[model samples]
Target: MTARWGNACDIVVFGGTGDLAMRKLLPALYYLHRDRHLHPQTRILALARARHEPEAYRRLVRRHVSQHVASADFSEDSWGSFSARLDYMPLDISQRLEFARLARHLGDSPGRVRVFYLATLPDLFAPTALHLHGAGLVDDQARIVLEKPLGESLATARRVNDQIGSVFDESRVFRIDHFLGKEAVQNLLALRFGNALFEPLWRNGHIDHVQISVLETVGVENRGAYYDQAGAMRDMVQNHLLQLLCLVAMEAPVHFEPEAVRNEKLKILEALRPITGMDVQDQTVRGQYSRGRRAGETLPAYYFEKSVDHDSNTETYVALRAEIDNWRWAGVPFYLRTGKSLAQRKSEIVIQFKSVPHRLFPGTTPEGNRLVIRLQPDESISLSLMAKSPGRGMALQEVELDLHFDEAFKRRRWDAYERLLLDVIEGDATLFMRRDEIEAAWRWVDPIIGGWQEVYRSPKRYAAGSWGPEAADSLLERAGHAWFDERGD
Candidate 1:
């Protein structure tokens, strides 16, 4: 289905010369343009401190775009047209006076959809918004997109929200968590709410537990400085994993509109059982990776990584058991784990159903049914169920009924940013986070961080190539559960 593209718009990307823009945002826009999703008259104006002419900036963008964008999608003809829409304006985001130049570049195009994508640090979010407003850049039809790691804590998140909210209304603010844009992530809503198969059985009585894991094979590479300050909790758990949990656990929205969908997600965040005091110690595991091997190559520990503090107590890995107090998922626990320098790179959500009341086959043990929704490496959904052996008396084995996205759908799969950028242009906030939703998540996450600071002196150590610390296994073992290893089957 083609998305409804709005009228000609201006997408002004702040920090356009930065890593995120060069690697992700630009390429995503290129794909949108290639697929004919972008309006013909749409203009992509890049604002940054780097002084470069429009042609020079386009050439610089071409190198990164070619490296990141797939060769199959990158045609000379497409790049020619895509580059025409790209413009560069050298202006420091911190300086309010420079925004007037941007305003002149944009001109007084009435009713033009203006999007200011702040791809810079969280500190710049407010200042950029204020300057945009001061320069008469922000209007009723204008929208602003804020990147992740919104703040260090709830108080700071509120401050950032207030500043951004001052310029743009809640409806026009799009706080992006790129994970929300994944095809499988959105398919989750369709699998539950759109289909009649699972919604009836999506409760504690039917589901035994849920596991959400986002493991990375590579460490903090060049983001060591940011990784040190944020760690796994603030970086991944507070936003990505919690957002995933809400989608899996939230009650069906009355409608699929922006507010209706986000309102239900907010309810889940508020209903989350707080992990504090002794519960933090018992229900959470924090770890830092040590030297290990990956693909026959030696890898350094998190502390030894470039730009990282050698004696930092910051955690590179976190595993927590989360519970929702609502009726739908009252007793069910959500096992959440995310870390760097792990065994493999994969993000998946496992929904294990309750076992049968009685064992029909005395000789064979029946495995419980499970729905595995994989988000990376491959986007697919597999239902695991016990089936009778081909030639045997009362013999059973677990088999997966799979739907691999690439194989199931013979079409080009879009990168997360592609869909998300398009949504912003179309003024659809369905996939974006709302103000209340952000605050609610931080409210649940803040206490756990405080508890860790007060109690734990240091993060546990685990080998770089391993899944996580031994404590993570123990966290699940205590609940009579285990981490589902995709490679095992």
Candidate 2:
């Protein structure tokens, strides 16, 4: 690993011995290597600050790969091939001179893709990029991949973007939101823009409201320290939740290309009416989770976690309503909610259409059309519409017209990492978040965060295993809307 192994390589993971490295990046690269999606001569070089030989590093990767890969896809050959492509480089990214080894290893590989994957902390990004630039490692053909919680606020986020932009061109920088790579998420673009059936009706005139909920089954767990610093706003709402909203509210792209799709998303981001001052409490709710049962096992409160602050007011849950002031969605509301504990893990978009002008079946029961798209654990799309109740009378009943991606596709689809890794290798920034998109999200979100600080001064408390605080439910209930639970659970 110390000496140059080969010429061509697609990805170079910097924090290769870290959690994201073993848990996601390495295993993902294995799948690409197996499928021959990666170039034959391509290499996977792992760079970490620790001094570890090739075999030790391979053992580190193999241990994680073995645990993460599905049992069905597990194979000795897969491990052998993937491990063969591994190389290790030990250097402190913070040291400008230390990147010389990386530069030497990457010398004139010509036309081959080179991605500097930053699995490290946000503070290290600028220094790493500067060091890479200093070593002449960043060239026209090279790209850098950045992971999230870009910054705590819009100002900090802008600073990061500015610092990176100083060294690398906009095109060479790839900021990722993994949710964008999820099959169902990308399928959402196709489900709407690619289909004529849905595009015409994708507006305030036809659709009523949209619910984007990201729920987790577990609490902060090992992430307590990081969660306290980030909270739900920075951790999930700023990136994951906003990305989902963009996909839902964006106008139809002219073509499905990067610019076209991103242009539409940018419009949605720009059109987001700010939530601040008087609107903060009316439109948003922040809460912290207390001790409660996770899965029949009792869990500690956030304060009890190893590195957490006992008196922290950081929210474990955040729910808010946003609107695009543009004509297409002028009055339609988009509700965004995310929280840990008290929810079976679920991420879905519930499109609840307006009730009919009049209830023709007044004395009986009546309902409007609705559609639900579930992304995690399973991928499915179902349209809720009224249908006959099977007796002789026209007793109306709501039935779902369903299409489950799993049940129908019948293929053991690759995980999000697999697809994203392929995209990185193939030089497709289609699903990656662009700079404007990142800043735009922070711009819309920063105000609500500030308003929360100025107003409530602290988050409402809700027990673990419960659906957030009463304020959360009231946020929607006042608008005559309710949250949707996991389908059929």
Candidate 3:
């Protein structure tokens, strides 16, 4: 498939030498170039303090990008063209004097889209924007892309937003949550709003409950310090899981424009019933992983990870029941759980429908219809329905109607970063979060964090290879529903 190219733009990556840039950003750009999604004139400027000539930087990037990008996608011919668009500049983002060098490198190109991708820490976000604006780099056509863990808490998030908002318009700021860039996630929006088959039956009356889980097989690894500080709630739930929940529970936007979609999402975030104080104990579970074997390999516990505190109380896993108090989803509970070092690495959304009011077949048992959307490892959508057994009278069995992206489409699937990068260049914010949306999400998540700090001083311990704490299973069991992992996908 020929990938579509957006407007010619200069993509400036702040932390160009960082893990995210080398592993995701550069590789995504390479695919965009290979697939013809990037204009020939588009430039990718690496802005970091690491001093390197253009040739040396390209060589470094080539090694990392080659290692990370799929073997089939990496080609000498494509690399030649992609490498030509690469440039580098060494500077301290904190130093206002370094801004002039960046501006000079960008040149005085008119009407070209400029995307400042802040892949650096949250602290640098505002300063970078300020520096850009001070150096006359900010323009109407300029857009900024921010990464996750926007802030440590609600107050800090607000401050960050205020600082960034001062320099760039909200429309031009793309607060990216890569989960929204996943193929299954986009397909989910299409499944809910594009199709008439599920829309009417998507509410409380027909759907029993919703489960959104993002489980990781790997522990903190190199992110021990950051993970300890942020934990699962701030790192995963505040952005990824909550964004998925909003997409699942939100009302159909009048149109699929950026604001049209975000407006409805904002409504869902606002409608989220607060899980605070006593509610936190009853509705939420936080777990820290202990030493255990995964896939025949023994792994250290969260506390023992490099740079992590020996007695860290930080949660490696979190499970919470979120309710949206709105007409579309009044009684329905949205079960959200995300963790590291789990049974497997998978992200999926399960919509289990309510069972039939009365079973007509006496000799057979009917299972409720379920729509399972898997987001990682393998991207596919499967709907489980009860059907009559092939050769038996009155016998029913569950059958799945599945759509696997790789098998169904016979083309290379675009990574989340590739799609998001293209969207930023195209000036599309539909897949990105707005400032109000961020504030609202923090508003909903703040109290939960506070509740954990005040009441639950330490997280429950679970084995590294396990699903999560037993409390998480009991969380679902109390309501007569088990996690999809526990129930068998």
Candidate 4:
């Protein structure tokens, strides 16, 4: 479907004073506004318990936006024009009376497309929807955006969906997974389907294994309480990593529209070989970060993090082998891993092709061709090829043909949130997760979580600055493969 870009819209962000608003949402909105991507009649309303007036809130937003957005992009002229569209309201969502005030504030603009972005806790998602419905604000033009950690498990996710679905139709609900909005992730689709080179060989016979890792150098700073309960598995793997896996493994859709794309993703999630019973122990590795040193500074253990239990058994890392039980990817393994307070900050996917049938070089046994798609620490796609060294008897050396997005585009790349927020405003659910997609992800993840509780009482410990527990390495080593480190090796 085409975007509803020209339509007048109202963008209402709940928890407008929260960290997500300051660091991501508002800054993204600022860029959209500066670029004139937003409709001329569009109005942005931020609702929070903070009692700042509209002008004061704009000033506060200006400060935060200036800090988060690059100085090269920020300017007084743009802020002045953008701030004209900004407004604020103070209300407690839990209070039923507050809805009346919000409805009255909106002043009966049924023709305007309304987007209610819930940047609050997952628990607030359903209630906010119900409140909006009761407040007579759930018109046909209204849409709702939900943030991640949708629920702790499948049951809770269904519960949230049922509750929110009761108020807003599934089509009007946007389940945001910011990872899918990244240019590199979208380019995976382009690189696969757009190019004739990869599709034919993108199967088990040609590709050996896939490695998807999202590593971080920073620990759970203020989210220790949430992290302890959710951990790396629920927080990162269930949504981000699985979504990446789907994009890599899904079949070519009939068309590039929302349902067509999501249907393919659902098939991949359903075809995932279930890691249950004894399989979990063999295919999965979980670890908690312990105190260690990185660079010149010492990093604290997960247990010592603020709001975390001292003896928390929560895992801060996860590595698992996921297989698609389909014709295209039957035997190929997709290694998914993510961790906090690790050696580096990177989000990348490594597609390792199978080795050549015969070695042509007499002295050198060259490695297979590899494609690396990096999403963060710079967005780029590089293919590793074996090239002959200078003046040698068939000596082979690995070289990369890299296409960095910034260098090639010669323009600022849109932050994931920036693109996603604009998509939501324009009523495009192509990048958003469907209700079935969310439940399907939870269905695949729930069994492993149960396996962890039943079989492994405590996660294995690894140094904070290390890649992960040694077991993660061995998880691949058994298959004669190794986790591809950041150095492209």
Candidate 5:
């Protein structure tokens, strides 16, 4: 399946019949095909447990592809050419013999890259990797992609890693944290390192506080089976939020390579002050969303989902006051929260600067600038600064120096999937999480989760459309701060 498309070969997508494939993967591949990004003979072989011929898979894909792809220039000729590269193989991880067909289909294409994408559940990752090795699909240059919710805890994550490590070297594994592929997230690094102005103010003395939030307006759609076992802490904050913390808090590395950048991120993770013992209650807020409105529609609570336990202690919303115990960010507090069924969907980092030393006029407004890096709903950066209200009097107010993606960049913005997929093809691991980085994140995050089980009897309940539990606001209220909104940016 390897193609002459500039040295890359077939992208062997496992769980190709899953949600991610139907919505994001195939559509992206279609666009890549339409734009001539793929090589002349490049192929995309989809593997799944369903019994289907290549033609049947093509039909199934055609229906979804037509729906997800917009009206533009997908001609019959283009689809025919793209469909010619479409292939499928039925697979069940538990059955060893089933993988033999997969292996035979992938015949020896020396130097042809084989990209294995694991979109299935975590439990299936190890078995699939071993089966790949057993089927002789593991090569020195082959690549394997691992999706997140890495594991329930550090121990389980390590166990999964050990299982996968047995078959493939660390270099061959690509751990995707789609957040990193976000344009603004990547741009944050560029802003900090590329600009001479920001780095000087990036330290403790000049900065007052940092806030990171990744909220969702939608409820757990059809993931109740998985959501019940893992709450907001493990499902989102542990991997995604912690990684964002690393990116924002990590010291700049000399080089931007995978290991170099991750090394600095690991240091920031290691420098994270542990939140175990008694202080857990003071520093963290955990809650579950009850029924409420979202995106102009009513939504149910976490327990309302089918198959969810009535007495579940799993949290749907979480807010924490984390501190990095390093010279660069000694006293600055990094507040992070993520939840489902909230007021609005927003993923942003707000840097609230310290107030000016002295104020000359009694009635004059005080000045404080905040740098907001937003990820979703929109991808942009805005610096909130003080401006004089237009009048005869010297009244002060806030104005923004904004870099909205639409106004700033005219090119078609790439989705997180596209950037991450390209990174996989080009072997760029800067945006991908590495072994130690994942382990370290879990190491720091596991204790916070474990602490709640021992101390907090139950998760505080917030309305589905509410902005998490009332307790979440208290985490910052005592520090004289509040969460950012669309207008606040």
Candidate 6:
């Protein structure tokens, strides 16, 4: 069934009944509606092959939203209003007649903003866009949203971009990476540029090294099929971790607008010193998680995960030291590590400042003055500095000056999807990945992958409950550094 609001925008979700839709998108939309972020006239249309009436789909969404959303934020009145904006259509995207029917259902409104959010597989992105174009559904007011890990490799990514470009102009395309939407991630800009305290020391002269880690406590129990093929390199490193790196390393933009912000990010990506051949062996470490115990419970190894090959050589963990060729970060190593089934679930960036040239109180602080930006579990920014211990003669101890966003702001932090989805609807591409940005990231990543194929065939094995293989620690230890273990440290 199809319904329309008079001349308002139509936000169509391609994979309306999928996990992403139920868990992230619809719940986000509900919040936007509840908070009055969406326009009063806007209508949400969910497109999928799942056969269901409009009300049936809305009920299904209600159950999910209730489970995912916080009790304080959800209410019966808000849900009633939000559900009224939802409409569902059971149409197979591959069928031309289905698209034709969709066209008639949407009708032609030149002024209406039509957003086609493709939450399906990357292979379907181009075809769906072409289908929309062929059915006379695309216009100047139309925009398309594509999810991350655009393609498996550089070649496929370019091909997908080219195909989608043929239907929608670059300005009309939005490639989303939800990591960019995190509040703490965005606060990096304000911390670096908005304040004069840090920008001067943001370079190699004052900084020793940088660490970015996106660790998880869950294994690939259900996503084993996709995880086995892509591994940690393609799955996390290629997009999310890289995007975070760009933001942290990027030069201040002339303006905070879309193109200005993206242009600066692009420069950082291009300046990344490529890791290839022998450098891959020296700077990169890949590992597969082995079954182990954590917190008195046994965990399964990557090989035992559902849909994974017993002999799969895919890496469940990756740790690498990256450097930028540009002057600002020339000598500073940006260490990135990500893995599944780790001891903790947290995503963070640690900026280790250089120790005092002359320490008056020796052995007081071993970890040097540092700035830590926590992105998940809890979002906060903290700076660790040495303070004089009570009733002591210059006895120093490390104390953190912390700023928790929730406690400071006194409001609910919007979900990453909530901010990103609204950004798409309003045509603000500042937080999105551009076509060239995606390609540049792949170019830097491809050489490391190629080196793995040629020499490093099988990934080393580490206990599932541990950080990663011992080699990951060795990767940093050679440079007189170590992985920043939040819990241990």
Candidate 4 residue lDDT tens string, 74-181: 999999989999999998988988999999988888678999999998889999999999989998899999999799899999999999999999889999999999
For every candidate in turn, the CA RMSD to the true structure comes to 1.6, 3.4, 1.6, 2.1, 2.5, 2.9
Give me the overall lDDT of model 4: 0.92
Candidate 4 Cα errors over 4 Å, as ranges: 1-5, 486-489
TM-score against native, each model: 0.97, 0.95, 0.97, 0.98, 0.95, 0.96
Distance from true position, residue 401, model 5, in Å?
Answer: 1.4
* List of clashing residue pairs for candidate 1: none
lDDT of 2 by residue, 166-256 (tens): 8889877888888888888888888886779888888888888899999887888777778888898999999999889989888777787
- Judge candidate 4 at residue 414 and give its lDDT: 91
Global lDDT of each candidate: 0.92, 0.84, 0.92, 0.92, 0.86, 0.91
Clashes of each: 0, 0, 0, 0, 0, 0
Clashes of 4: 0
Give the number of colliding residue pairs in candidate 6: 0
1-489: candidate 1 lDDT, tens digit per residue: 365456899999999999999999999999998888988899999988999999999999999999998888788999999999999999988888988988988999978899999999888999999999999988899999999989889999999999988889999999999999999999999999889999999999999999999999999999998889999999999999999999998888898899999999999999999999989999999999999987788999999999999999999999999999988999999999999999989999999999988888866457789999999989999999988878858688889999999999998889999999999998999999999988999999999999998997599999998878999999999889999985532
lDDT for model 5, please.
0.86
Off by over 4 Å in 6: 1-7, 362-367, 487-489
- Selected candidate, larger TM-score, 3 vs 6: 3
Q: After superposition, how far is residue 121 of candidate 5 from its true place, in Å?
A: 0.3
lDDT for 477 in candidate 2 is 88
The TM-score measured for candidate 2 stands at 0.95
Looking at model 5, which ten-residue stretch has the lowest summed lDDT? 1-10
- Position 254, candidate 2: lDDT: 77
Better of 5 and 6 by TM-score: 6
